[model samples]
Target: MNLFSDIRTLVIDNLNAMVAEGALPDGLGFDNVTVEPPRDPLHGDMATNAAMVLAKPSGKKPRDIAEALADKLAQDPRVSTAEVAGPGFLNLRLDTSVWQTLPSAILGAGASYGQSDMGAGKQVNVEYVSANPTGPLHVGHTRGAVFGDALASLLDYAGYDVTREYYINDGGAQVDVLARSVYLRYLEAHGQAVAFEDGTYPGDYLIPVGEALMAEVGDAYVDQPESVWLAEVRSFATDAMMQLIREDLALLGVEMDVFFSEKSLYGTGLIEAAIDSLRDKNLIYRGVLEPPKGKKPEDWEPREQTLFKSTAHGDDVDRPIMKSDGSWTYFAPDIAYHYDKVQRGYDLLIDVFGADHGGYVKRMKAAVSALSDGKTPLDIKLTQLVKLYKNGEPFKMSKRAGTFVTLRDVVDQVGPDVTRFVMLTRKNDAPLDFDFDKVLEQSKDNPVFYVQYANARVNSVLRKAREAGIDVDDATLASVDLSGMTHDTELAVARKLAEWPRLIQIAARTNEPHRVAFYLYELASDLHTLWNRGNDVPELRFLQEGNTAASQAKIALARAVSVVISSGLGILGVTPVEEMR
Candidate 1:
């Protein structure tokens, strides 16, 4: 159970009683009332703004209302003291029993302790790692892949129906370029000299695709014209590149529920249908955009074009949907893609994009808004760059990727768990520095190691207890009497455990999975603090010698920490280490 929510309910019940007794006004809005941990722990265990928020509304002094509210709250068995702080704030100190019993509650819930129904089962489409199918995924796409996959898992934990999706950028001229590059490789496989001129991929990764093409049709397309091989090779090369990308993602433990092809939108009526839907709403028009700011009039010429009135939906300006050559502009297919998402009946849409695509955020949001008529909410999260370092110096690029570090390069060096956790150590919008030497260090400064160490320590405690002939299973520990757990340090760790459910709701509402990583670190810190304190105070140790009763109660708390850590790491797509090697 959520202790914070339980206490908030207690606060509201007392307020309603005060209103019934005519001590407060009949109708004071309780929506603004909130109960949270006090800013300074020295003040109290929890603080509420019930008195302060209702004072002006009820036309009564805050202190007068606080005093009456305090009397009502103090009568409850859970609250030990309810005192009025500065101006009308009410600070509460819960009974020691409240904190002592939290371990039992945590054990009872197990890994589902922090799972929330905040989303109420709404369908959410999360599109991420939609990198061009031109080559294997690079380091930048790795961050987006981790962030998006973790977000989908987080939303799932928060009770949202999540769909992990990847949009393939295979319809553009880039595929044609890939085909030509593979043709050069094919020529090389046929023992012919070839040069990769401008606008063609020169990476050795495509050499295999060229060799495979020669093996598939031996000497058939040798010295053939462009028309004879362009379409066939484009399709073949796109599949190969996609396969490489999928393998790279698999290396990092990411799997997508759908792989949407942008090519499907072409040679079909889907694009026209999406544009016509907007046309029916008077959002499509033939107009000429004004010259961009800072451009001299003599340096530009106006050209009338088919445009979408994106300004009506929140874009900075109207955007062209068709070029002067009468072909669809880049933004048209994007609109069609989003329109298809809206028609799929999803309640929410979330796109994880690279930081370079920040400018596309507003236009994409505008498109979804116009398509869904502002019904379906869309949130675009932009993942920033990751700077790699080795021994405090900048790391070199991957030879396989040619110009950038591949996802497999990072995963192979540090393994998937370290790579995923380090990627999420920073906020998505903030730049992250991944230091190879520092992340693997087994010290408190290394959050991943510290957190994993805490879990490992819990496993050690369980093993010791079991060897000592003390029953430490969840059912037995949950039922153990915890009245002796009155040490200040012991109670502090329990207090942190009580915050898990509340933190889950906050992180889910804000769509920030990084907060989960941060909370796990804090929880791990509290656990380590208590574990170290036991050395000075022998009686505070989890395995109490010759006392099976006391040992089970103490070990219960330690095991509860592992349960929460496992749940948190699971959401981050990192397997919890039972024993850190």
Candidate 2:
């Protein structure tokens, strides 16, 4: 029930007919043709660039092509008018009945009204919030988590086979620091005073992990040296931190399909295998890199290191994969991780990284490009910082996380739904100012509340209709005669409803789930506008005086708005409220 797609098909069919009748030249490529809403709604319902794109190719003036195309489109039953405007663009107005019947389509599709098959069931791997397994997830990781989860849901709605993944950075020195930190807490649990050093984690979140360790081992390693307990405590602490992370994510309604440990890549020959695969392709070599641009030559010393020829795959320069000491560099494990993803048969891979990882993007893409032989495409989306404010002042760090605001802190302050919605109100790469005071307000400025209120209003209409003894079930309302729904205000909402499927494809294609949030806001605005119009025009109200059939038709339109709102909110992983609380 994609009305825009249906209308576009009509335009294409008429163009093909023109070609067949020799009204236009044969073999004209129609791939570049596009049908989209006009920039100014007063011009027409939709606009197309068919004439402009085909003018040079057909050796004809754009206005001539547009005029000819307009005549053919005007003959279609769906197209009430087609007029050429501004040299070449063709503006189209559809029959009123076409918009009038959209409620039936929305009722028929229900929550699947805007679902798309654009992804064609392609396998996509989305890795996000791969925060180090050392402590609770902070506000920065929260943004990535929300963005990644919404994107996965968006792709799923668009018919992609999506797998949510998390890469645990447990094999690094940070985890060792976490182990020593936990050792201090464990000694405290055993009634010994301990001090946290500069390099050790001092957050109270680790206190429970240490107490749990004391319970498990029963002071077996209390007086032991590092060699006797480092490995055991490191493994134990990592598992505890991961458990804490899981709880944090659960608070925000996020669940990962896979948790890949960096430790698993080590001691398994996986890192060597990934590097060897590149070496076999002449990508890996031993070389001396040029001195970094900002540093003086005398301050730099060139050393032979193992490198990957990342420049061949669009990176700024070749990147080192192994150090001069023969130990695998940080990039080596990441390469192996992506190599594993490629071997798993994913058609696409998306990584949600923090803004600080901007420099890592090109090299990571190069690694996947080389590993997959340029078959699998990789997209990295970076989430920027979030500044939190409460009572018009900067929110301070949590005592639990010590130096940062944990994901749980946000979720606990506001519920998961508000946290998720506010996080996605801006683009992924744009910094967001989260004002706790403003987000919970009942005003229209709060997009989440406004959208939810729209859904609630729809339910209110349904309840009032039932109380009036009108059978306002979906089937009854969908079957009602909507021929009387010709008001410009009412039709404006229907026009927005017709754009839902089109919006889904655009957002999915661009890999931007924030577009969904923005669209939902606009849709809610349209719904709210119509609701307010009813206050002045009695005829515009959803319920008519003792006119059951007419009331059913108007109520159907309101229900359709809720249907689409529910579907969009579902994609954002937010539960659409049936009643405002």
Candidate 3:
């Protein structure tokens, strides 16, 4: 079903045949041979770099190999023409029938047409939006959440067993700060005036948590000392914050398969075990870290502490696992978390972090590398910041979160589908602008609307065709004789359809979900362009009066386009609108 892979196989097979014919050297590696869309469409439907890659290795001129290969490829029925282009690149133009047959192939596969086995059932754990469990998620966390969810779905579609995970950062001192914040609110609820210290949370979101705490204990801890209430309140406040976090994620239609508690790593021998694994490899040591480059933090006093030789595994510097105060550092809990992931038998680990967490990427990768002894690879994807705007001006922050917009603020403004799609309009590592006015605008400028419009328009075609006494259901249209779809515009849509399987493999292999968004936009654009062309050429219209046969063929093409759009949107966690509202 993968047309590109199919062409690659053909190229490889012919290379073997060339070996048998003694036209090329024996046992030449074909791994370098790749069949991809030409950089310029006018070059050909596809191009290969086989001759160029093999020229130096075979001690033969690339043009000579390309010329011979072109002659042999032209003999294949699917290959209409083949020519050796500049520098031994071979460009191929496929037969019209080859493109025409793609719609039927897509119909046969339904939504599973572009599914790939590249992942080969590898187990992948994706951790994302693991923001501190002290407040609701914000726009920064939203980008990471959407990116991670889409990536997990992409890997799943590519045949990897993926587990969505959220690391609750509940064991840190920040949760203690949250407890104090909630206690202040609790005092406020009991009609006692309280002031928020600079380090304590001052968001109104904690007001509800305070009220609930007051309701639960009924002033039992109202006048108690810090030792008696701090522990109990800290645990209660963390659970409340996590509840808020979960609700925020749900607003964006995200659900995690695992919620790992950072506290679980403590008092469970997990942290010691993770450090012990590194110690066995002589990676753990006690040493004073060098003064950080440039402006170091004010607390940068050089003190000997337990450290991990992270530099050995490709970090900027060795990282500390325990502070000088005999307590595990923040990095210590993280190491244990990933070590647990390694112990869970996952073949791969992926962490989708906020752009601000870019500093942690190298150290985390180093930890996973050391813990797994380079056997398992960890990929850390940092989603760049998302800037919010409305009415062409930078959107201001929510008073509740104080300095940033919360995730729910976005979902409530535009539904989750809009939020998720707009967040992915750019590369994960590139900054994005989420404008409420722009994204919700009913124009081509909004990708979600354009893609959904294409699907809805396809459904309209089906409705009109069926009303005209033509059976337009998938089962009926798929059986229609689609050979009449020979116009260049009609065939162009089919050509895009042919790229579906190939596009999936590329995006999946690169682990880039943004490619899927780009592909869907291009596919929708092609369909829309064809529609605009039909406005002038009545014969090209999808529906023809008293000509159900031709209409069915055109409608079948539209249905195939819808199939690809819907499948791509499914990967993006967006529902394809069946009818435009």
Candidate 4:
């Protein structure tokens, strides 16, 4: 149950009663009213702005409305006290019994404790890590992959019908270069010496692809012209690279629902169909774009080209759809891809792009707006770069990838759990430093370790209680009497537990999975604080010397913390450790 939502409903219901009694006006919008945790725990359990937001609309003084609302709220069995704070704010302290019920509720619900119906099963398509199928995923792609995968899981937890997608960028020049690179490797397999020029890929990962091609066809395309082999080899090379990419993603436990090929948009008139949808609205036209901002007149030339009126929908300038040679621009394929998604009847579209694609954000949004006639909403999140460090120095590049560190390079060094958790400790748009020395340090400074340690310690408590002949199972502990848990420190962890559902709603609404990571860290801190206090205060411990009932009551609290921690880690795509090793 969402405690904050329940309390806010209480405040609204009381306000409605005040109106029925003629103490306030008939018309008032209570949508702006909110009940949230107080800034300082000493002040109260929850604070509401109900009185402050209603005073002006109801034609009453702020303090007068607040005082009246306080009396109505104080009468509830759940609220122990309600006081009018400065300028009409209302602070509320909940009854200890209210906090006591949370552990039982959490145990009853298990991993589904914080699952929300906020999205109401809206169809959401999340496309991420759509890297060019020329090589294995790198560190930058790793961040985007982790972020997008976690986000899709978060939306699923919030009741959205989410489809994870990957767009294969094989309709570009890069794939042709990949085919040439593989051909060189194929020649090398055939006992011919070759040189990898400036444009072709030089990574050793392609050596296997080349050898495979040699094994498949046995030198049929050995000295053939570009005309006979370029197209077939391009298709073959793209498939191989995509296989490598799939393996890389599988290593991180990411699976996609769709893999759309850009080439499908080229031959089947899909791009034309998407462009025609815009033309029907008079958005597609032939226009000469002004010279780019910092260009000299001698270096710039004006050309009339097929363009989309992207600025009409909030882009900085209009964007071209076709080049002068009648070739589709890079944005054209992206527009068609999103158009395909919109046509599939998705209610929302989310694109996770690399930070280098920041400039395409507005134009892509504008295209979706124009194509969907402002019906479908597109949100693009750009994941920034990740700097790798080991032993306080920058990490070296992967020889397999040749130019940068591959996703396997990071995962192999510190397992996928640490890799995924450490990737999300920072915001998506902010730069992150993934240090090999720090993330696995087994200290409080490592968030992943600290959070996992909390869960491990909770299991230890259960083990000790079980050895003491006390029933510490979820079924028995959930029915234990928790009314004896009145200490402020003991109740603090329950209060934090009550915030899980609210936190999930906020993070899902904002499309940010990092918030879940942050909340888990804070929840872990609260659990750890209570566990540490048990060392000196025997009554605060999870195990009681002689009283089995008291031990079960305290163990219930620790078990509840692990339930939420496991759920939160599930959303972040990390496996929770049961025992510290």
Local error of candidate 3 at residue 20 (angstroms): 1.5
TM-score of each: 0.97, 0.99, 0.98, 0.98
Off by over 4 Å in 2: none
Q: Give Cα distance to truth, residue 92, candidate 3, Å.
A: 0.3
Cα lDDT tens digits, model 4, 176-233, are 9999999999999999999999999999999999999999889999999999899999
Tens-digit lDDT string for candidate 1 (1-581): 88888899998998998889998889788998888889999998999999999999899999999999999899999999999988889999999999999999999999889888888999999999999999889889999999999999999999999999999999999999999999999989999999989888888899999989999887778899999999999999999999999999999889999999999999899999999999999999999999998999999999999999999999999999998898999999999999999999999999999999999999999999999999999999999999999987998988776778889888888999999999999999999999989989999999999999999999999988888788889998889899999998889899989999888888877789999999999999999999999899998899889888989989999999999999999999999998878
The lDDT of each candidate is 0.93, 0.93, 0.90, 0.94
- Please say which candidate is ahead in TM-score: 3 or 4: 4
- CA lDDT for candidate 3: 0.90
> Model 4 off-target regions past 4 Å?
none
Task: List, residue by residue over 163-281, the lDDT tens digit for candidate 2.
Answer: 99999999889988999999999999999999887888889998999999999999899989999899999999999999999999998899999999999999999998999999999
Off by over 4 Å in 3: 295-301
How does model 2 score by TM-score?
Answer: 0.99
Ranking by lDDT: 4, 2, 1, 3
> Could you report the Cα RMSD, in angstroms, for every candidate shown?
1.5, 0.9, 1.5, 1.1
